[model samples]
Target: MPVVPPPVFALAAGIAQHLLAPDRPAGGARKLASAGIAVAALGLDASAVAAFRRHHTTVNPLDPARASSMVTGGAYRLTRNPMYVGMAGLLTAHAVRRGGWLTPLPAAAFVVLVDRLQIPAEEAAMEANFGEAYARYRARVSRWLPVRA
Candidate 1:
């Protein structure tokens, strides 16, 4: 089963298509190059998470339907929300690569939708199921960024 809703996936696919589409650079070469690098990095990170997921079977976000074991290996060691962070990174990179005054709107919309809708529901379910374990993990791992401390 897919993790994200079909509409969310559609929006993500559209943004990705826009990012990959060829166009004359309205923005400078430097900005375009930076965004391309960012997108590449995001893709690499996402691949890493996918590899980890394939290797381990204990990283489900849906608590009621989660695996019995907690995953602490691979990308989970760096952050609790690696998959979501990867998705956000991809969206940000897509926005930056697009390059316009309104370039960030789609990324902002993604953040709002995930934060306001998906994450809250997931967190509540996690909290109910995992209790202190989830809390401790949250305290350690940054929500959509790597933990600095």
Candidate 2:
């Protein structure tokens, strides 16, 4: 289990971004893009949660081993870790809204930390629980985003 939930880290990083550059002026384009990204991120989270509920699996990230079944539908088809990706997207949206060179640093750090620490542990537990099925899913889906080229 991860010592800290990914959301906590994301939340802290978001707060840090504002503290670093609270008054950074965002233009209309930035605000629009931020809103779009935030909406997409929220939708991803909702879809992932619904998929887990449909599969009768646990949504608890700290206990992947307790997952009753694998969730391959909805947002899971695009990314193995939609919730984490959503969190990252939200941070990115906040960074864009904040609009400073340094604002994105915290979001970048959140991605690195989640990718390196939280996700690997979850993947291991998932592999242990689902075996070849999860291996196939892992192979089919990207961890955070789908490949375009």
Candidate 3:
């Protein structure tokens, strides 16, 4: 079975909010901030992908079996789920751009769904494939945020 890429799902949810919301708060600064957030989120995504590529692993989120190597540098050093983090960031930016009290709902839902559904499965697969190395990595890194222990 093909799983939906987390980023795509997140982006879709963000876009849905943009489509369903009736109004955007009137402000140039808000839009600029949103744009800045979106750009930064995308940069994080790209960096994650680049790191994966450098590690000679599959960047395709749907095919865990295709992953050829473990990645533990760059964005991976910060968060085990940088791709998901970036996706959430994109969704957050959309929420900011939409500028409604309810705008965050979809992004929150995306994070919940991805965290509960997607990440565990990936972690399991990595543990199965990479064994102790993955365990060490998991022990060292936060699943979402990068905080020093």
Score every model by TM-score.
0.66, 0.94, 0.91
- The model with the greatest lDDT is 2
Alpha-carbon lDDT, every model:
0.62, 0.89, 0.85
The CA lDDT at 105 in model 3 is 87
Query: Across residues 33-93, which tens digit of lDDT does each residue of candidate 2 receive?
Result: 9999999999998888888888888887777789888888878888898998899899999
Cα RMSD for candidates in order: 4.5, 1.4, 1.7
Candidate 3 has its poorest 10 consecutive residues by lDDT at 18-27
Name the lDDT value of residue 146 in candidate 3. 84
How many pairs of residues collide in model 2?
A: 0
Q: Provide backbone clash counts, one per model.
A: 0, 0, 0
Better of 2 and 3 by TM-score: 2
Query: Residue 67 of candidate 3: its Cα lDDT?
Result: 73
**Candidate number that wins on TM-score, 1 or 2:** 2
Residue 60 C-alpha lDDT in model 3: 74
